[model samples]
Target: GGPRTQLEYRYVGYAPQTVEVGNRTMIDVSLEQETNELESVVVVGYGEQKKATLTGAVATIDMQDIKTPSPNLSNSLQGKIAGVISVQSSGEPGYDNSTFTIRGIGSFVNTSSNAPLIIVDGVQREDVNSFNTGIFNNIDPEDISSISLLKDASATAVYGAKGANGVLIITTKRGVTGQPRLTIKVESGVTNFTKTPELLNGVDYMTLYNEARRNAGQSETYSPRDILLTRSGLDPYMYPNVDWIDEVYKSFSSVTNAHLNVTGGSEKVRYYVSASFYDQEGQYKVKKMNGYNPNLSYRRYDFR
Candidate 1:
């Protein structure tokens, strides 16, 4: 042999090749280097759509967002979605309903049913006012898988008759492809009036009354013993400068809720079973009000 020779290679990617001379042995492997980015797809009513493909003006509320600071389903939707308005007509416990509208006023003369249609898990839920006795509690927000509102006519045309007003499509939780998944959610918090009114004290009340009397030029030194006693603090119980509103209202009301969900299975039969317990009290009112709502739900989904 004349002299020994050495070969060197410099490259960024694999390229299989062979350098041969008189007699030599070599093996090479070429592999395509790739960078892949994974994405999630959400299924709307009619077809499958990527999150980015949505352009028809829609709002999505998921389960995790429901189980947060506020347990009120109607409160959760307040100002969260664009072009949607939720007005809570009353502050009474267990009596809150949201009036949902789409793209301002769709009808010029029809105000009877100005609200958008509400569909829960493919079941139409109209005439909610008829059931406003507070007998039925709303769907547990924690149990909701997703809430999608169809805002424009183009998105609402699929459901035709029901979509004339608008669409509020609610899909409940379901099972995934895995072992049985269990989710436990618990929330406890106080409920207080946003702004409580202030009533006049007894002294102020008498002062106002006497001032009115003076203004009217009635100079009869009106001395109702009850008023005199109240001014003198003679009988605190009988003429107490009591805050009747505070006396009737609680220092703070409370609500506690707990729910458990069991889900998951194979391809054939996937199921979701959930139960919840809720106890809530009123914020500000003359009488005390509390509620207990125990719910059980079962759903079987077939992937056909």
Candidate 2:
């Protein structure tokens, strides 16, 4: 026989005990428990549903697999999702928005409308075609909690006209009923050309050209001695055995990203705030007359 007090804690473990005393009672408690997978909620066209009950063709992206440093979410989604094809057309600093397709090309009549609709926090955004660069640059990757892609018609039918291509639902992180927590993440890396074309040098070019001329029943413009001089690396100014690929392209470029996030609150009201900074230096090297070399670079700061 004893007095007992019961308390409820969310996402936490607890131990209960009973105590008894003459006319007065007190219960000492200790906590130790682990939480496991709960039901997952997914957002669809106009409402939300449990992932287990959803009948549409949907795929959830695992944020853990997106380890590459990218300026936009599109770049990180490359090859990470099923039936999605992402192509980065250009490596230009801020303009590096990747072109992505859901399933496959739907129609050739209107190539411009092939892009999927982007919905952030249940609001439809403007078509990305209107923006010259990646419209998602303002979004910090750390702030994203989950990304749900709706592919089939039954899944995207709610949008009516805009549902022809598909739909991409982006969900941001929200504070939970817990102690205030702060997280800081920093990443830095380098980018370089994976492969470059192998072009013929000046001597090889001259030899090939002379061979072609001889095949056409014409005299060889470059003599064997001339070819030897070009191959021997003598008087480059005159022979001009230039490797244009090396002259134009750089070996590598640098990239850096940093993010800070704070989240916490009570069950009634929660808050999440984040700030991020990203910088990427392009591989293009421009030579200036005054002994200066400038490389294309991009810097962006984001707050949410």
Candidate 3:
């Protein structure tokens, strides 16, 4: 024996390999390692921190969880985050920004400050509401990569006064090192009311009204003949029984959305481009004097 030789080497990676040769063994070995979930980095107020090291309360919204179509990005956050309440105050065309509150209502004194601070790409915005008319639309949801809600004082203290109501950090998608990729998505559908109130017809409405009037010690406004005339579709011009609810609401409204995205880049330079169009028609149809009926329609064009 050549003075007993021993050698050892250690490496951390996937799989393990070993080889021995002659008396002086030469060995090659590899060790597998597990990923530490705590090491995952998350966007915080002013900076990023590892999830495991963060002591503040935070909640992340999964983009996949947003399946419904919405005019404003805030509307998509409904029921997606825990301890966060998102409410669409109105569905009016181009003015549908959902109100969001973190950890419940923090202040009733100032309604303006009740909303969480929205930070997009490190820039702070008062709220997602759009004032320029048209369904409070701002920021295309397709461009969003991640949304993190910063709760608790520890995480929001970095933002000073702005963070008192909490903070929402929105990160847009970035190009990665790979071949150029193009994605086009098209969605078209109709929206119908989930539930409609049971309404009375002309005769039934008159009957109920007359009964109520009689109970209140008043004379009946509609006679039996009047009810029959309104019910029969013949004297509409004189004794009209309009179904206001049916006339105001449609059976279904159309919605169409299309988005195109292109992304590619190298280590030095990366780029992401996206274009989208959204068109939605409201259920309410208004007839113009020019014999044209137009539904409350909203159209939005987005480019990034």
121-158 per-residue lDDT for model 1 (tens digits):
77777633333523112577767777887777777777
Report the C-alpha lDDT of model 2 over 1-304, residue by residue, as the tens digit.
3334344434312333333333454445454543221246777887787765778887778888764677887788888889877777677788877776777655422244787788888887754433544455467768888888898989999988797777988888998778989999999989988788989988889989999999999999999989998988877887778888888778888899999998999989999989989998878777665765476778898888
Q: Candidate 1: minimum summed lDDT over ten consecutive residues — where?
A: 295-304
Residue 122's C-alpha lDDT in candidate 3?
86
What candidate 1 gets wrong by more than 4 Å, as runs, is 1-42, 51-55, 69-72, 105-112, 127-137, 224-228, 236-240, 283-304
Clashes in each model (backbone N, CA, C under 3 Å)?
0, 0, 7
Task: For residues 1-304, write the lDDT of model 3, one tens digit per residue.
Answer: 3535444444532333444444654455565553455566788876788776778998877778764677767778888888877667667776766776666655423255676777888887665433442322457788888889988898899888888878889998999778999999889988777788888888888899999999999999999899888889797999887878898998988889888999999999999999999988888867666766566678889888
Rank order by lDDT, top first?
A: 2, 3, 1
TM-score of each: 0.70, 0.75, 0.78
Clashing pairs in 2: none
Runs of candidate 2 exceeding 4 Å displacement: 1-38, 108-110, 128-133, 228-234, 287-294
- Between prediction 2 and prediction 3, the one with superior TM-score is 3
Worst 10 residues of 3 by lDDT: 128-137
Better model by TM-score: candidate 1 vs candidate 2: 2
Q: In model 3, how many backbone clashes occur?
A: 7
Whole-model lDDT, model 2: 0.76
